[model samples]
Structure formats: structure tokens, C-alpha cells
Target: MTIHRMLARLAALAALALFAQPAFAAECLLGAPGTTQRVEVSDTGRAMTVHVPGGVDRIRNLPLVFLLHGSGGTGAAMLESSGLAATSDHHGFLLVAPDAGIPVERGFVWNIPGVPTITGEIPTEDDADDVAFLAGTIDWLAERGCIDPDRVYATGLSGGGRMTSWLGCVAADRFAAIAPVVGLRAGNPLPDDPQRPDPATCTPSRAMPVYAFAGADDTVNPVAGGGAGYWQYPMDAALARWAEIDGCREEPETVAVSDTIEERRYARCDGQARVVGRVVAGRGHEWVADNEAMWMFFWRYRH
Candidate 1:
């Protein structure tokens, strides 16, 4: 072969090797189960801990659940407290707990302020655009082959619960089902008058299933009450309104889950959606142990 031709061939082979090396390296990196990694989810440089379980290469068409922590809590704490990871692992699903992005000395709150009964507003200043961040997180995970776009779900406790309601009202299309524990409606009393940035205005474009839970005796997000510092009215009103929107039948099927938990299911609604209200007996403002029941109920429905 001529020296010039040999040189040209060698150059081409080197270029091919260089190009193939990176692809082969990437494949090697993706060969294992997705590892737990921290990702910056917001522009403020706040990071969220994500557990991919197995690396991206091992995941395909996987369902993901966003677990929100309550007031004065962290994503890690909420995940640990909720015992959701175990459930996710058992069910072959991905679990993600995003930090509230609010820095609290001990933990964090959902950015909701003011007493429930009072005619006061829950300050939303620290209420960063969590909805956008969540959407981005979903997209990011999807790119990693770690999330199933059609099976995304959200659930939270207390303030997190309230946030879930907000998501249902605002980003309804993003979630197949939502489970809010100890949270109230997005905007109570339908917000007297419609406004531009109102959550009630963003009702689901399509029917979305919701499973709500609260301790009947929950003094924090009470079940029935209307007074200064009471927020239960809005919660009750929201559930009823959602029922109407979903066209749920008036009477709910009441059943007992356990001595401490009684369930009221409103099913066969518009779009075949349903809401199961789990009234915890004597429970306080907390994520009751019956979460497994709620999780089971949540897994049954999808978009």
C-alpha cells in the first residue's frame, strides 16, 4: 500500500476508535443498576437525593412515586419515615423524595403558614415553583430510562399532603393518581372570585384519581370544623368539589381497615376515578401506618 493511503486509513481507524471508545465507556457505566445520586433540581442550586435502585440500563418502563415530606422534615427523613422505599423495592418501582427547598433549623415545612380556622392566608412566598421542579425531575428521570412517563404518582404528609393537592389542581395531567395525607384543598370556597394564579382554576384536564387520608381527630388538618384557625372546611369542601368534578356517587362505601382506620371510598366517578378517604381513629396529624393500604390503593389506579 502507498504510504499516503496507509496514513489516511490509519487516521480513519483512529477516528473510529475515538468515537467508539466513548460509546463503549458509556455502555459500561450503564451496565450496572442505577446508583443513588444527588441532582440539582432547582436554579437556586438546591439538590435532591434520587435513588435509582439500579442504574439507568436496568430500568425500563418503571413507575415512579414522588414522596413529599411534611412540615419540619427533609426528603431523606420522609422517605425513611414513610417506609416507601421498602414498598417500592418490593413492588419493583422507583421512589423519589424531593426536598421542600426550604431551609429549616431542624427540618422543613411545606411553606404553608397561618392557622387553619382563622381567615388568614397560608403564606406562599417560600413556595418555590415546586411544580416545575417536579416536572423537570420527571423529565430527567425519564431521560435516564428510570421513569415510566405514564405511571407517575405523588403523595405527601401534612404540608406535603397540601402540596399534593396543589399539584392535583395545578399539574393534574402530570400525575396518574395522587394521595394526600393530612392536607386540604388547593383553594377553599373556590377562592370567592376567580383569579389568574389560582390553583382551583387548574383542575384536571382529565379525571385524576385521588386517595385522601386524615385522622378524623386530626386537630392540625381537622376533618370537620369551621372556626378561626380551622382549615378543615377547605379540605372538606375540596374533597366534595373533586367528587363533583369526578362525578362520584353521593354515598361512599364505608369499610373498616383496622381498629384505627376506617375507609370511605367514592368510586365510579367521571373517567372512572375514585377517592378513598381513610379516617384514622384517634390518630393525630401524622402519616398513619395504614400508608401501605393507601399505597396499595394508589397502585391499583393509573392515568
Candidate 2:
């Protein structure tokens, strides 16, 4: 062969070798099961801790869950407190806990629409685009063959829960289901239409299944919507709006989860959409059986 032709062939082979490398090679490598690894999520240098269960790669169409932290929270805190990583180990799904971009009180915070963050006491434009960052994270994992596109789920605490609700509003088509704990806030009613409620930021392209939990005695976000502090929707109003969006039956089935917790399941919905409201009686603003209940709720639906 001519020297020029040989050089061209060698260059082509080198290019092919480079293309064979995984785009997320630094992030997607399998680590010890249940061990957390922090990796970059996007071009902006955002990062999250991903936990893979044992034998995750062996399973087909594995489910993935995004666990978000509340205001003044971090990914490490969520991993330590929520016990979601343990759940992932038991269920053989991938778990990712992302750190919010906005910093507050020595921790991070999410940019929930219309909600006053810990960093900003007053409502204002969001400092970071968390929605886009999470969407990019999901796509990145999908590209790396780590997550099932049809079975993605999201759940979170207060500010993070509000962020989860925002996902249900704008990113309905991307997730199978969502469960927000102690954080259900609907938008104010539209002008000249008290009967119709408008959410803070919703552009739902599909019917999203939701299972929300709230503390009846939550002084921070009282279910009655009349407590002091910033104005927000009550739990019932938020559930009603979700039921309307999902086309669920008017009445809900009431079941007592515990002596203190009541579960209201909204049934007979379109596109397999349903909403379950778990009101923890006498409890304050905190999580209630969040890990188990949300897993059960999320497993029932798929994108």
C-alpha cells in the first residue's frame, strides 16, 4: 500500500477508537454497590451523587429515582437522612441525589417557582435553572445506558418537593410519577375566575400521576392555607387541581395508613393518572413514610 493511503487508514482507525469511548466514562463506571459517587452532570459543572444497586447492570430497563433535598439541604444530607439509597439497594434501581445550585445557610437550595427560597426571603426570578439541569442529567444517564426512560421518578422535601411539583407541571412527560412530601402548594386562583385555580408554573403536556404527603399540623405550610407567613395553597386545593388535571373521579377513597396518617386515594383517572394525598395528623412539616410510600406509588406508573 502507498504511504499516504496507509496514513489515512491509520487516522480513520484512531478516530473510530475515540468514538467508541463512552461520553460519560468518568461518571457511569460501576462502583461498589450502595456506595455513592459524585460526578459532573452537565457542561456547567453541576454534580450529583449516584448510587447503583448490586446487579443493576444485569437488569433490563432498570428504574431510576431522583431524590431532591429541601431548602438549606444538600445531596449528602438527603442520602444520609432519606434512606433512599438503601431502598435502591433493595429494589435494584439507580438513585441520584443532586445538589441545588443556590447556596443558603451553609447548604444548597432549589429554585422553586413562586416560592421564597431560603437564600431569597422574597419571591424573585430564580437564580439557577434546576429544571433544565435535571432534565439534562436524565438524558445524560439515558445516553450512558444507566436509566430506563420509561420509569424515571422524582421525590423531594419542602423546597425540593416544590421543585418536584414544578417538574410535574412542566416535565410531566419525562417522569413516570412523583411524590412530594410535606410540600404541596398550588397557585392562586385566576383573576375573574375564582372557580378555576392557576398553578405557579405549569405547562403539563401529559397527565402526571402524583402521591403527595403533608402534615396536618404543619405550621410552615399549613393545610388550611390561612396560617401566617407567605400565602400558599392548602393541601386539599393542590390535590383538587392535580385531580382536575388528571381527570380523576370527584370523590376519594379514605384509608387510615396509621392512627395519625390518613390516605386519600383519588381513583378512576385518565391515562392511568391518579393522586394520593397522605395527611399525617398532628405531625409538623416533615416526611412521613416517604421512602416506602413513594416507591410503591412510583412503581405503578411508567412514562
Candidate 3:
């Protein structure tokens, strides 16, 4: 680990130890572990389904992960498809699958501040603040002693993945890390180029730990780019941009992990952090992320 990263982790651990106690004494708002509870966020008029592991207490200083569904998909659907609850059960963390606020035909799409969605709809400031809603959810859970506020993380599919990327850009301090699947962008594409991210649109408060995933056979949100107005840059460009944002000094390295999965990473980073990703050879535009693999990346960071 870089000395800077080691010191940051140590400092964060000290802060967590000092501040996490009072919240731990409070009763958690959700049902006990081994069960799932659907929660309504009355303020945002959206909902989330939360789950914890079987054996851990509500106050175990656990890691928290948010799973975001694709466009026209619900949080419960994401939970079922990602197979993440099972991984949480085995690893002992809190999991919440949250819905997008804007209602589309069958489901919802995120209200990313200034960009248009795949539906070709641009979000107005009047729309529900999805970013605030997500960050607020973490504060609410921490208040109820339901999760470790410092260990919070997020991951999502398709449109949800774009939302995940947005969070890493604007709410880097609020979330320790983020993983966006099938849909990853540093920011809205530059208007002139349409194939490059506009740097001004995604300046984060910190170097966010980003692990992204895309499938080789996907057509909807192709890894090589060119799909919707919202998706114009290649997946590698997105990863490379994040690697630059994270101050990684080395070129990305790729290794064939297996027939289906190819692992790529930028390991020499400023804070002992890595920008990592996977490309699934045969999979398409679907939830093909390894839940275990994502959780492993998430646990390495803390707010």
C-alpha cells in the first residue's frame, strides 16, 4: 500500500471508531438479518429493499452496498438477477436495492443532473434529486445504527450503472467506492465529440475507487461504445478516464482469467487504489457482474 493510502485508511479507521458508537446503540429501522424488508422513502417517494446477513447484528460496523436496476427495471428485480443477497449472506454485509425516481413506461430511470437518459429525456432541477436521495439514505441508515456509514458502496446495472458512475463523480466523499455494470461513463459526452467525456462534468471530491464491468457481446450498451445519446464513449475510455482521475501512474494490464472473464487493472495508483474491470466474453447486456468479486473490491475502501 502507498504510504498515503495506509495513512488515510488508518485515519478513517480512527474516525470510524470514535464516531460510530452512538449510532450503534440505536435500534435498526429494518427487519433483522435473514429477512428482506421493502422500505419507502417518503421524502423522495421512492423505495428500497434491504437485506442483511443471517448471523451479524444490526450494529456490526458492516459494509453497505446499493444495487441499482437498469432502465425499466425495479430494485427487487435487480436483487433477484444480481444474486447479491446470497453473497451478502456469506460475507456478512448490508444490501439495499434502490429504485430510480423518474417513472418510465415499465420502471424508472435516474435523474442525472444535466444529461439526457437513454429515453432522450433531459432531467430538470425540478426532478427528484436522485443523488441527494442516495446520500441521504446512507445517513438515515447510519442514524438507525443499521450500517457502517464509512463502509458504504454502490453498484448498478445499465441506467443504474450510469447513476452509480454519477455518484462516484459528485458524491465521492459520501460513498467509499462504486461499481457500474454494462453502463459506465466518466460523465456526459462532450457535445462536439460525442465520443469523449467532458472533464468539467465529472470532477469528484476525491479519487474514487471504480470497478466497472461490460460484456463483449452486448449491443444495447456496447463496450466499444455507440448506442444511445447518453452512451457514446467506449468502456475502455471510461476506465482509462477513471484511472487518470485516480492518479494511477501505470498503464492498464490485462490477463485472461478464464474463457469467459478477462481481468484488467491499473494497479500503480496514488493511494494504493486500483481501477479494475472485467469483460465477459460471451455475455450480453445483462447483469453479468460477479457479486463476490464486487464485494471484495468494495470492502477495501471506507469513507
RMSD for each of the candidates: 6.3, 5.5, 9.8
Candidates' TM-scores?
0.76, 0.83, 0.89
User: Model 3, 10: alpha-carbon shift in Å?
Assistant: 38
lDDT of 2 by residue, 12-97 (tens): 99999999996742345546765788878667688898887865545345698888898888987887788887788888888889
Q: Write the per-residue lDDT of candidate 3 for residues 1-303, one digit (tens) a residue.
A: 999999999999999989877533556757777888898765666679888677775545678999999988889888988999899898898889988888889888898977886678798877788888998888777776677888999999999999999999999889988999998889888989988888889899888888898899989889898987788899988998899898999889998889889978997776667888899998999988888889889888886
lDDT of 1 by residue, 1-303 (tens): 999999999999999988887331111111234445555643456666565554333666678889898867888888878877667656667778888755566775554333221214454655555677788877776665656778898899877887787777767778888888887454443344321123445467777788888877777767764422324354455666677667787677788888877877777797778877777888878886465665676677666
lDDT for every model?
0.68, 0.77, 0.86
Clash count, candidate 2? 0
> Between 1 and 2, whose TM-score is larger?
2
Clashing pairs for predicted structure model 2, backbone only = none
| Best TM-score among the predictions, by candidate number | 3
Q: Please count the clashing residue pairs in each candidate, in the order shown.
A: 16, 0, 0
